[model samples]
Every structure is written in structure tokens, then in C-alpha cells.
Target: MKNHFLWITFLLILSLNACKSIQEKANDQFLSGQYQYAINSYSQILEEDPDNPEANLAIAESYRLSNRIEKAGPYYEKLAEEDPSFETLYRLGLSLKAQEKPEEAKAAFEKAKGFTQEEEYLAETQRQIEAINLAKGIDNYFPNHVLVNYKDLNTPGADYAPVTSENFIYFTSGRQASGLYPADGTPYTKLFRTRAEGIRVDVGSIQSLPEFQNEEGLNQAAIAISPDGNTIIYARGNSTSPKDIPETALFASYFRGAGFTQPIWMPVNEDETWWNSTPAFSPDGSELYFASNRPGGYGGIDLYKATKLANGDFGNAVNLGPNVNTPGNEMFPRPAADGKFFFSSDGHPGYGKLDLFVAENDASGKQVIKNLGENFNSPNDDFGIFFTEYPKTGFISSNREGGVGDDDIYFFEDKTPKPKIVNVLLNVYTKQRVAGEPDAVLEQARVVLYDSANKQTGGDFSNTNGRVRFTLKPDADFTIIASKSGYFSKSIPYTTVGKTPRPEDLVQEVTNITLDTTIVLDQLILEKSIVLENIYYDLDKADIRPDAAKELDKLVQILKDNPSIRIELSSHTDDRSSDQYNQDLSQRRAQSAVDYIVSQGIDPSRLVAKGYGESQLIIKNAQTEEEHQVNRRTEFKVIEIRE
Candidate 1:
């Protein structure tokens, strides 16, 4: 019986040794950065020993190193519940934040602060708290644009970062999941292309690059084409051996006739350990912007800029500074026209994970960053934006739910309506009288503008169409003087007191309010009789009646307006009156009219009154009452000129 017990104990010892051996093997894979293999091995160990710390921790960290930090949330929750530690709780916060549980994440971070007295650690924890609060404030804002998933281009593997050039669309995708990357268990990304119109990509036209440009077991992604469309720069590199540190570098290619030339390693990559990717060119193609994890940055994966040298090589790299870079990773630098640029970041205040942001110069000319709002971003890995049109239309990438793949491409267009504006303008049509009608438009006539203060604001000549325009201020009064050579000058008053539209009425981006008027000017020619209508006198009286005085007032003002000339005021008689009596009465009537003008503050030297007795009439052979009435009329002409 004792011998039998020893045999059973020997079997138990062997099984225990075998379990230890399997666990050590998985540990080696974890330490060596073989996260995918470690995850698999840890999963096997977890089946038998669900409470094992080493196996659970390896699986969680493996997910993190593979850029799948979201997958670690469940594991971290279990581990923290079992035995909470500073590392476990802090990482738990990150996992919860990635899953869009901000309140829970904040609590985890608050607990983590007590585990350490390090200032940097405490400061980081506070930043997380502050970021969560800031994001809450941003949640109230509507999305600047609406994003549409690329249902046609996305696959089960990762696909992202699409750029446009000419008639083609360029992007990267990982379709082959068989040769899984050790760190991620996903196939390495490769450059892909398809026909496109604007932001729309054709599904059936998708094609991969030649084998040379798409090397096996390597990642070729994050392509940026120059504005000229002749050059393209992309990131292409990954470590095959565990002994070598994983590296990504910028590669360039030039287009010739039909296809792009073989990509050459760029010189800007100074070191293999720099870990550069996601390159973009300035709109002018004079500078290159990209993301890197090199030393001397604000923190993890800060953005950098390098000027294109005269020899076509890039100058030394320079960090984008603190306002843009932060403690967390910042990737995908996309520059737009003007001084604005787009990028993605986790360090900035965002909804969750990495959110796209734009850097713009504010009114004070200082750079400020803004979130893209809730629509284009979510609680997932959102990054890699390429703007097809500035601030409006663009391509984006996200790993949010409802996408076809892990990281899918999307197109966005700004749907926010533009602000309303109301512009008030006055258009004037200047013309002169011809015969009895005002049909002759006076081209080249000078139109002078005056403000409410009576100061000359501006002056301009009428166009060939006899049209002149002036911008009018809301609720203001003004006068315009229209004058031309050999023409009588006149002033017209205009007001825009109630012409403005209410704020609510201006619903369009631009609202135009145009007011128009016409002016008629008479030519100042000597001996050009200017008949004055609506004047009358009693039957045969030589005295000027009250009605006659009213007609004379217009002449009084005309003489006042044209002060440089002397006017002849004349009175005529109808043929019905006897010649001798008409002659005698006409002279008296003319003298009476002139006497009235002299009484109204006019210089006597400027008056020249004449009488025509049945000699000057508007109508001859006056038999009817209407004809006789037309025959008896008053007239004046510029008989004398002082100019």
C-alpha cells in the first residue's frame, strides 16, 4: 500500500513540473514582447488556473501592447476586484476611459493618487480628471460635420487613412490576417488604391501595390501625397526579429508616366529607433509634418515638422511644442490651407480614446486647439484624417462600433449652416432730359456722396449704363449730388432708416438689400427756352395773381440752384387779345413777375424779364380753349451766362 502511494505522488510531481514549465514558457513570451503569442499561451493557462495573476496580467498587457487597450478593460476590472494595486487601478482607469465610462475611470484615478507621492504621477492623474471634466463640457456642442462609414472599402482587418490625388484614392489596409504580427496578431498594413470621385471611393476598383512597394511582413501605411500629385510619402517598416527594436520610417516615391517609382528610404529618418510614421506635407509642399516617438518631446509620440531642404532632403526635425503635443500619444498630422492643421490625440480633452482635433490661430494670432465634437469621434480609436476640402469635407478613420472592420475609413462633410449677413446698397440711375422726355442717360456724370454730418464721404462717376452704386449704412440718412458738364446739378435725399432686415430674417449666408432711384438733369444752354407749366393770370389783368406767384416760386428756386447764370423770366399773351392791348398788358405782366422775384432775396442784377405779345407761343392757330390756354404760357432761358 505504501509503494502504491509513492507511485501516485510521483505522478502528481510530474504533472506539477509540467504546469510550471508551461507557465515559464508563457512568461518568456510576455517578457520578449511577443504579445500575441503570450496572449494565446496565457489564455490556455487561464482555462485551468483562472485565479492565476501572472497569466491574467500577461493577457491584459498583451492587449495593451497590441494597441487594443480596450480589450484589457474586462480583465483589469476582474483583477482590480480581486486585488487592487496602484498599477492595476491606474490601468483600470485607462481601460474604463477607453470604454467611455468616465465617472468610473475618474474614481479609479482618484484612488490611484493615494498609491504614489510622485509629483509627475499625481499631476498626470489630475490631468486625466480635468480632461474628463472638460470633455463633459464639450459634449453639449453639436458635431461640426456628419461622418459616413466607408461600407464598401472596409474589411474584417484594419483599413484607414485615405488620401486623394487627381482621380485616384490611396489608403492602407490589412487584409491578410494569416501572417499575424507578433505584437498585434493582425496582418501588417499595405498600401491600397482605388478609383474615386471627390470623397467617394469605388468598391470594385480596389487594388494592391506591386510586391516591391508592398513588402511582405512589413507595414506600409499613412501615405500623404504632395499638392502637385507627383510625389507621395508614406511610412514603411516593422521589425522581423525580436532582437531588433520595431521601427517605422518615411519612404518616398515619385510618379512618372503610368506608375510610381520604387520607394526610397528618406534621409530624415536619422535613426532606426526614432519610430516615425503618419507623414503629411504642407499645402505648399515646402514643409513636411509627421508624428514620431523620438526623444526630447513633450511626451509620448509628439508631432514634428521638418523643412524640405533645397537639395530635396529634409532638414532636422523640430517638435510642434506643448500647445499641440501632450503626455499621451498624438498621431496623424494633417495640414490644411492657411495656418490651420488637423491631428488626432488622446492627451487632449476628448469624448474617449483618441479624438481628432484642429489647431487654428485665434483672433489674437495665438494657436488654439479644438475638438471635432461627438459625431466624428466616439469611445474608440479615432484618428488619421485627411482633408479633401478645408474645414468642411474630409476622410477619417475610426474603430467605433457599427464599422465593418477593426479600423475603418469614413468621409465627412460639414453640415453646420453658415452665419447670416445683410448688406444694404443703393443704386442710382442718372439721366438727362431730351425734348419732353427724360430718355438720355448721362454717362460719366459725377455722383458725390454725403453723410449725415454733411461731409463729403465719396464721389464716383456713373457707368455706361448710367448706374451708380453706394453702400448704405443701416438706419442712416444721406444726400447724393448728381452733376455733369453743361448739365444742371441736383441734390437728392435718401434714407435707410427702416430698410434693414431683422436679425431673424437674415437666414442665408449673404443677404443683399438693394434700393434704386433715378435723377433727371436739364442741359444749361443759352437761349434754350425752359417753359414753366401751371401758371395763370386773370383775364386781362396785368397784375400777378396769387396762383401766378406760386408758379414763380419754382423759378425762384431754379435761380437759387444755378447761381452762376442770369435767367430771363418771360410772359406771353394769346392771339385772342388785341395786338395793342396785348402788347401793353404783356409788358406790365412781365414787370410784375420780375418785381416778385426781386422781393424774394435775389440780386436785381441777375433778373432779365421780357414780354412777347402774341409772338412766342407753344401752340399756333389757337381756336379751342385748350389751344388758347397752351398759347398763354410763361417761359425762361439762360440768356446770359457768367461762367
Candidate 2:
């Protein structure tokens, strides 16, 4: 009995020490601004002591600070139900406001205003109510656009901050399970790149940038590339600091010799006390824009600009001033090439926590601000606007509902009405001419397109249906060339220049007028005499003339189109010289034709040179000059078909 009593006393002392340890840890985490960790620690204490007011309050405050306001609402609601303090009611109202429940938030703020005695608290409560009222009617001023989530790049984590360079998109993502920060139990964000086709990004090609990844602690994000694409600026968080609240600083790196150099912190970075992030460079690379919470700002986070010095360093940072910055956070400043500034703000009247806004100088040189509207902004945080070369399409980052992650990137494009387009459909066929049969589809025939200037525009091989389609510009002329091996090439001219618009076409907004046409190519048969009309040697010389080369080019096209067919190029001569001399000259001429075809990318094995000097002639007893000219000619016959 004496030993049992001692064991019970030991257990009570251990329990008291555990409770004290948890309270100390929770308080330490809260002071360090690691709200997620603090919530975990405080919840552990509350599990054993359900009625502990300190633990309950710490958990609720942590959730609020961590931007998990929806989760914080229930804790604050329970406390208000039990004790109804002014502070609890005020915080609950802010939580409701962040969740976009303006009606409920206004009521809570009104009740809190009645209970608060401090002038500062009463003024803030009134401001909160007014802000909620403004938010209720802000949707009427938004622009029309379509928001599409980036299904390829997002995971069940934070994926945002997209910037485009050429054909690749550089973004930030905390998708890796490892390298998580202990403060929030969330993975550290790292810079990544993926290839994009137009506005569609290939997620499977996402690759981590090795020069910016931090294996030990927090890494870089919010990338901004220079106009030349040789330089990059980003925000690197200082997670290795021993202090409670870590800060992020701006850094720049140059892409040199096919790889990026080591990133160096910008000289404009203030001592670790200030947080600077979301860097954006002007199109000319003369100025750098970023967000900073440093001293002397208009509000929570103000936009600042630093001019690029002659020696490649930055000048003193200057705030954008009251016209742009406000009491709430202003971040993600993107300067478009078209002299427009875009940023996110909560201080301005918006639809949600952080709505995207555009600022541009009007004709009078006054800065005009406009909200992006309901299409782009949601009830959740939406920022990070990135525009492509095309003005109508761009990307935005949002943590809205139905996202694959906490903050997923979305692509937005303006699909307003535009002029109708026309389509040209080409059907390619091969004319076999097998005694009495019709033409058939020429599968895999090469179809090339050329504009009126004879410059090659685009080309594609015919599919199984022997068809190809091209969206030609209206009021233009084009030439379509179809060629196949063992066959003659054919060129067809198409023009939409003289086409008159139909009566119904004038009324439609957008329409695709399909103009269909068919082209036929004749096959080159074996043992057939096809005399080259202009292939004439000069004065008994074997040297080919320019006129002969023009005719032989047709043969080159035939060889290229019919790659599997072997042909014999034969040369015939009139009975004017000795048999041996005529035979030698004819052989040289035939070899010359074969050499020219080989130089034009046709395989040498596919061609054979033969000379029939006066032995095989079209005109047996040549008397007239025209008959003699026809006797001396060059012709090619399909000797063998490989397929």
C-alpha cells in the first residue's frame, strides 16, 4: 500500500511537467510566428485539459494567423458562445469576412462595436463593417473572362507564382514530400520549369531548378525573368535563421553558357528584419518592381521599384506611394510589356481577400486602377498574374475551391467575339490509270504549301484518307504542291481573293467556310517512253543546259516522292556521229542525270544510267529536223518497285 501511494505521487508530478512543457513549447512557437506548429502544440495541451482557456485561445489565434480562417471560425465561435468577449467577437468577425460571409461578418462586427470601449478598437470595427458592405457589391465591375485551372501543374500542395519565358513556364511549387519546414509541416517551395505549347503547359515535364532548390530549409519562389531571358530574379526565404520570425530577400542569377550561375542576394536587400519578395522586372530591364513590408511603407506590404544602375547594381528602393499601396497587403506586382501594371490587393474594394487589379496610365497621364473581376478573382486568394505574348491569354494563381492544391495556378483567356475564319480542305489523289480504273487515295503523299511569293509556308503528309486541311487567311492566294514517289507531281492554285460573302455570312459572328478541292497525280509506269521536252545537249557536248536542268527537276521530285521505286534514266542520240562516239556521249549524259538526282537527296541505288545511242529511236528514219530533235532525248522508266 505504501509503494502504490508513492507510484501515484510520481505519476502526478510527471503529468504536471508534461503540461508545463507543452505550454512552453506552444508559447515559443507562437512567438516565432510558426502558427501551424503552435496550433499542434496547443491542441496537445487541450486534449488533456478540455476547459483550458489559454490552450483554446492559442489554437484559435494560430489558425487565424496561418490564413486557415475557416478552421479558426469554429474555435472562436465556441469561445464566443461560452464567454462572449469583445476580442473574441471581433476576431470571429474578421474570420467570417475572410470566408466571404459579409452578412454574418457585418453582424458580428456591429455587436463587437457595441462592446468595445477603446476608440481604436471601435474605429477598426466600424471600418470592418464598411469593408464588408463594399465587398457585397463589388462584383458588378469585373471584366468578362474564362478561368481554367492548370490541371497539369497542381498537386495537393501549394503551386503558384507562374512566369513565362519563350516556350517554358517557370513557377513555384511545394509538391515534394521531403524538405518540409518544421514550422508549418508543409513542404518548402522550390522553383520549377515546364514546357508550354501556346497556353497549355505539360505538367509531366516539370523539372526542379537545381540552382534554386534548398534541401535544408526554405527556398526561392516568385520568379521574374528578364526580357532577354538571360537573367532571373526571385525571392529566397531565410529559413536557417535562429530568430523566431524568418524573412525573405530578393536574389538574382544569370543564365550563362546553358546553365544558371549561383544566385546572389541583391544589394538592395535590407537587413534580415524586412521581408522582400515577388520581384518583377520591366520589359527594358531598367527597373525592378517588388513587394516589401519594410519600414516607411503605406501599409502591410507596399510595392517598390529599384532602378538598374550602369554597373548592373540596383539603386535605392522607392515606394509606389499612396496611389497604389494601401493599409492592406499589395503584392505580386507584374509590369506587362504594354505599359500596364498588375498587382493583388485586399485594401482596395475587391471580391475577396486578394483580387487582381490592373493599373495603367490614361491619356491624361493619371494612373487608372481597375479590378480584374469575378472571372479571375474568387472568394479565396487570387494573385500572380502572368501574361503571354498574346494579350488575350494569360495565367493567374488562386487558392479557390475545387483546386488540386492549396494554391493552384489557372489559365485565363478572353474569348470575346471575333471575325469569322475560313478553312481550305485539300484532297490528294494518285491517278494510277490502270487501263480503265479510276484514281485512288494517295496515302502518305507529301503535300507542301507556298504563298504567292513562292516561299514554303508549311507541309504535311497525307493521312489514310488522303486529306489535309489548312486555315488560310481570307483574301489571299496559295499554291498547294502534291508529290508521291513513282508518280508525277501536281500543283494546284487556290484563291479566296475573289470569293464573295454569302448573304447569311454577313449575319453570323464567327464561321468556318470550308473550301474543298481535289488534286490528282499521274503514276510513272514501267517501260514507258516519257520524252523530256527541253532536255537538249549543246553541240554534241554531254554537258546539261539550264533548260535541261529545269526539265530534270521534275524527275528529281518524282524520285523523292517515290523513294521505293528504282528508275533507269536513258539517253538517246540522233545518227549524226560515229556509233562509239554517240554511245560515249549518251552514256555521259545519262550519268549526269543520275548524279543530279542523287545530289537532290535521292538514293543512288534507286537510279540506273543507260545509253541507247541511235539503237533505240522513236523516229527510225529521221528526215525532218523536228523528228531528229525528238530522237535525241532523255527519259526515265520505273524499273522496280521495292514495296
Best by lDDT: 1
Worst 10 residues of 2 by lDDT: 1-10
Question: Could you give me the TM-score of model 1 versus the true structure?
Answer: 0.68
TM, every model = 0.68, 0.60
How far residue 198's Cα lies from its native spot in candidate 1, in Å, is: 2.2
CA error at residue 618 for candidate 1, angstroms: 27
Q: What is the per-residue lDDT of model 2 for residues 391-497, given as tens digits with 9 covering 90 to 100?
A: 67888999999999788989987766565544444343433335467777777778888899988878888878887766676677888888777666677778877
How many clashing pairs does model 2 include?
Answer: 5
Error in Å for residue 460 of model 2: 38
**Per-residue lDDT value at 584 in model 2:** 89
Q: Candidate 1 lDDT, tens digit per residue, 313-409?
A: 7778899999999988899998877777889999999988899888898899999888878887898988998877766787899999999978999
lDDT of each: 0.82, 0.77
Q: Name the runs in model 1 displaced over 4 angstroms.
A: 1-18, 139-144, 176-178, 210-212, 239-245, 254-261, 416-643
